[model samples]
Target: MKRSAAAFFVSVAVLAAGNGVRADGPDEHAGRAQEYILANDFDEARKELARGKPDDVGIATERARLALYEADCDGALVTLSSPDVAKTEQGAMLADIARGCARVTAANVLEEDHDQGVWIRYQDENDRALTPLIIETVVKAREALTRDLGATWPKPTRIVVVRDLLSLSAMTGLPYESAQTTGTVAVAKWGRVTLLSPRASIHGYSWRDTVAHELTHLAVTRATVDRAPLWLQEGVAKREEVRWREPGPFDDRPSPDAIAARGIELKLDLPLDKLGPSIAMLPSADAALVAFSEVASFVRFFASSTPPGSLERLFAALRDGKEPDSALEIASSGNLKQWDTKWRAYLQSKPKEPLPPLLSLGKEPAPNPKAPSLREVRERMRLAELLLARKHPTEALSELERLQLVGAAGAPQDDPSYRYLRGRVLMALADPGRTKEAEVLFQDPKEVLSSYGPWWALRGVLARSRNDEAIAEPSFAEAVATDPFDVEAACETLDADSPTPPSKDPSPLCQSARAWKVPSGTED
Candidate 1:
């Protein structure tokens, strides 16, 4: 989700009325600054402010507004709280918003790290594990966005990973219920990317993609100078989210087109025009998903139909104060309505039977009260793991079989932990048919990719068993990528002939994984 404010021009009008002064009366420089700020031309705004008296309240407020647009919340607060600006009506309103920014960012950030042009902040040292991945994603995403949208990062971009929903709400000013209802784990606001940690989600999320999505919002803000409407902002972001990585396809299984097609069939699709404000504020999780899918599909359609660099021109038009409909006219075939009709016809041509799963906060499904308690389930899983570790394959297999029987009522059939353990047991037994069955269990690479280390490591093992180096290599790489602290996954990615692979360009995680040693109890 990307947070947008009501028009700044409206605020400027309110400030003028409250002070009983004409907006352009006796402060022409301040008035010009306000116009530049609305156009998202901060450099021009700064130049205009320089022409005014430094202590002027209107100049000070516009300066603070520019800082806010750039995600410099602390700077904005300082300007707003200065003696000359603090007492004025305009300053007071800007100050209040700055205070919220302080609460969301500076007040909550407990730790920080930097790499290249990116900085990451979090409350826990444990989240250090995510720093490398965040940096990697941002570095790649920055390049992709620059190439595609001509967006630039004027300063080091910041990524703040908060631990829970309360922190997320405080940071983004999204109501707690709205975020919970729509399963919004992240938002591009305060000129930074603020997100919940992957640990906040029970099954974990495609956080790398989420990071790319939010980063795209920041890019759109920059390219359009805060002029992008919610639909265009979100639509472009969704279209670019997966473009930052290899094998990244916009039309993967249950793709945007597929989801949008299904949403249209169900008549649940929100019109792009009616996706009021933000998808995070949609009525339900289903609405949010449908809306996202719809916009993503439309953006893809719009981008494909237009000539190369049409998106860049679109952003330029928006930044220059063109209305969205007119911007579309500049970017594509003249009539927005006709293009939308063509997009709909294109969407209807997509496969819609397998609708993507409804979007959620990636929370675990609540256990059925009549079924076994979660603790009991964990204990049983642990017992099976211990038996396997002790070389008691028969007992491990038996225990796992019993676990399946008891947990079938409530446990997710695709739970990665269970599959990993069962796959391990099957490997231990050394039965050819069972090994094949284990391969079947681990074959769903998308599921493995979204899961934790165990599933990824297990998939790597299965791939190696079949002498499939192509699958084994990426699987092991993903295992380390998923959980840097997982010794098995880390060590698995190391080459047999040498401690490290021969690649000249090794990732930070890969370097760590190559050097990491397996714990004593773990098998080679």
Candidate 2:
């Protein structure tokens, strides 16, 4: 969280003035506004000042606070027109503070380089918005992975930061059907890159761990490319996350007895080379989770069982384009299939623990006539996003409907979030009967959600249906611009070449699209 030096200094000056000022009066209100500004709660401070009796200090102070928080000087200046605020000592001090904030914010905004994919655009009332932090995290993760895991790291890496969870889901086509939402996802194509949701907390091990996990995917993907196995990919990614001490609470080393007690069980008999393409398209969610877990376990096994140099030798074989079966055979001196079978038999023979109770089940129904809160709606929407990511549209739609019901009850009808999610859920269904419903959401210009990748993708689809290549082109372009690492969106933008009036400056998107030339028959 970045803070301006001027804001910090002003906050200190305000705090030093002390509580000798009485409560329940204008001075007390002024002190509260200053406190709120320091805490980065500009919205509440603005509301408080707006509702109170006329006071120069309250209005000017609030303006300064907004400017400092949003990095929007123009917006702050426009709000400082209160008559009472135009004539006071506090007003003069606020003018200086506002000017300093404006300079700092403008400098920071202007200094950001868009072409390099260094900063992400986002709005927040608090300290530096999540976009910049996500970008920095990705850079740090890539550097760490490249430094620690030399031969395995992918080349020409990039990172993308989406504005919201819904946008993140839209880019990855990850449905919001499940409860747990992913903070980041990696797609290793022309280069290794990760797309992260900026809304997630950027501090602590959770965020760092997500970066490590995604970077591991990049390393494993680079090692295997087309020949990478699912189990190996997942296992390596998980191992890398833990290897970096990122798995945090889950990182304790098991006692030798405990490790023996929890015997290794590789359930699937599939060879490692075959794992790459099949794991993503697994028919059952349970099967997919099991596959991922098994992969993690297998990587852990290799990391523990083999000599230090053995893992590097295995990676070298993978880098040389050897199949996992051959690579494992050469590196470990064992038959890959036989080893897999042994591991599976070992797993099946172990005593299995009972699964935990489902949180979605056995919950009391909501009280009759009570609508869900915005937070509840947001959470359900997040689940819908996960379901979509997991490729479960039917289940995602169920959650979307619940979200719509909540939205209909006094939530802003024009809210972009509701429309965007609805559009995505409908698009995933791909039923012609639902096209109009999806179109309704896509066509809303006021939809705040339209700025996101999925919404733009849906818009492109709608435009394509109407043979309006102009509209479709920009929409696809916007999607790619927002998520530079999205292969699907990049393809759509490249294939779509309609001479549309530029909705946005087309230079960046067009340049990026042109630069992304996939090998003739490569599947990303």
Best by lDDT: 1
* Candidate closest to the true structure, highest TM-score: 1
RMSD score of candidate 2 (Å): 26.9
TM-scores for all candidates: the values are 0.73, 0.38
Provide C-alpha RMSD values for all models, in order: 8.4, 26.9
Runs off by more than 4 Å, candidate 2: 1-128, 131-148, 151-156, 163-186, 196-207, 224-226, 250-280, 345-355, 359-524
* Model 2: per-residue Cα lDDT over 94-125, one tens digit each: 45444533443342222244543443322222
Clashing pairs in 1: none
User: CA lDDT, every prediction?
Assistant: 0.65, 0.46
Write the residue-wise lDDT of candidate 1 on 1-524 in tens digits: 00111110000000001111222224678877765554456788889989998767777777887787666778988887787677776676667667766765654444344437777777544566567678888889988888888777655777778878777776666777877767777888656777777556533455677788888887777677567777788888888877888763122545668767767876888778777767878776666777777888888888888888998988888878798899878877565678778999987765555532212222334456655655666667677778887878778888767654333433345556677778888877878888887788788755521345667876886677567889887777666544554544645532222343344345544444444434323531
Give the Cα RMSD of candidate 1.
8.4
Q: lDDT score of model 2?
A: 0.46
